[model samples]
Target chain A: MKLVPLADRVVLKQLEAEETTKSGIILTSSAQEKPQEAEIVAVGPGGVIDGKEVKMNVEVGQKVIYSRYAGSEVKLDGKEYIVVRQNDILAIVED
Target chain B: MKLVPLADRVVLKQLEAEETTKSGIILTSSAQEKPQEAEIVAVGPGGVIDGKEVKMNVEVGQKVIYSRYAGSEVKLDGKEYIVVRQNDILAIVED
Candidate 1:
């Protein structure tokens, strides 16, 4: 099943952290702080919140940075996704 | 010293958590999930991001809700604040 966010939330797939440094030494997962970078998979339709219309700004396929401890990690169809509110996103990673 | 956020960051002073129940039973700080509500203090002048100008939508003195684990807890002048990017704010509380 595909992960989808409701309300002002977004579903993001975690981008894999670098496994090696410039020298090419493969580091284990334990050596990395869990990467907070993610690719947006889906976003909730903007809803009226507190009498104001909150609009969805980011689009699918956009990369974003989020607070390290922001969202709940979930697995769907063997893939990992983070479900977090749009505001939990720190910045859109322009590439 | 006051806290000022650079770029799209915002300085927020956390609102107090409730310490009692309807029956007038007092609850300890440990018993409450750390409150995620805050009052905006200073907002960064929205800079050119993604080649698009992101304007400030919320103003100072507005109350907001944030992701529970999003911002870094900071203290200035004996008062507590949270430093987070604008995206880390979920919604403005209309009062």
Candidate 2:
């Protein structure tokens, strides 16, 4: 089953460690650090959350940087994803 | 200087650990668990944050239960306080 995030939550697919890492050296998946970069796999509908009106700014397929300590890790369909509130996202990664 | 929260931020004064623990046994301050309960010391004006409109639902002197891992601790004038977003607060505790 696919993950459908609730209000103000976005589903993110973490970018491959080697792809985002600035360091030329490549590390195995298990050895890679917790990269803060990720791609928006699924965007949640922004609505009233905790009495706050949230508007989703990032669309699916956008690369973004998220807070290191934010979000919950979920393994679905053998793929790992992180579900975080829109506020947890710090910025949109530009080309 | 007094802490003035900005944009839906709330400054909370953590209740003494000994007062919150229900266990008949008493523990030293250093050994007490991270109490999730606190009293609201100051409230921020509701406004736009990250493109979302937030309204503060809490008031000063109200006891509330907040998320365990939420907010940042600040030391002001030798008094410790926690600064957290309004959403971090889970519920109000009424005696």
Q: Determine which window of 10 residues in candidate 2 chain B has minimal summed lDDT.
A: B24-33
- Against the true structure, candidate 1 reaches a TM-score of 0.46
What's the TM-score of chain A alone for every prediction?
A: 0.75, 0.81
> Which pairs of residues have clashing backbones in candidate 1?
A87-B87
lDDT of 2 by residue, B8-68 (tens): 7787888886777753324232333233788998887757786566788899999887763
**lDDT for position A55 in model 2:** 70
Model 1 residue B15 CA deviation (Å) reads: 31
lDDT of 1 by residue, B25-50 (tens): 33233332333667898886676543
Q: Can you write out model 2's per-residue Cα lDDT over A1-95, one digit (the tens) per residue? A: 88888888999998786665552222111111122567889988988777767777768998765554658999998999999887676445455
> Which stretches of candidate 2 lie above 4 Å from their native place?
A22-35, B1-47, B50-95
Which residue pairs come into collision in candidate 2? none
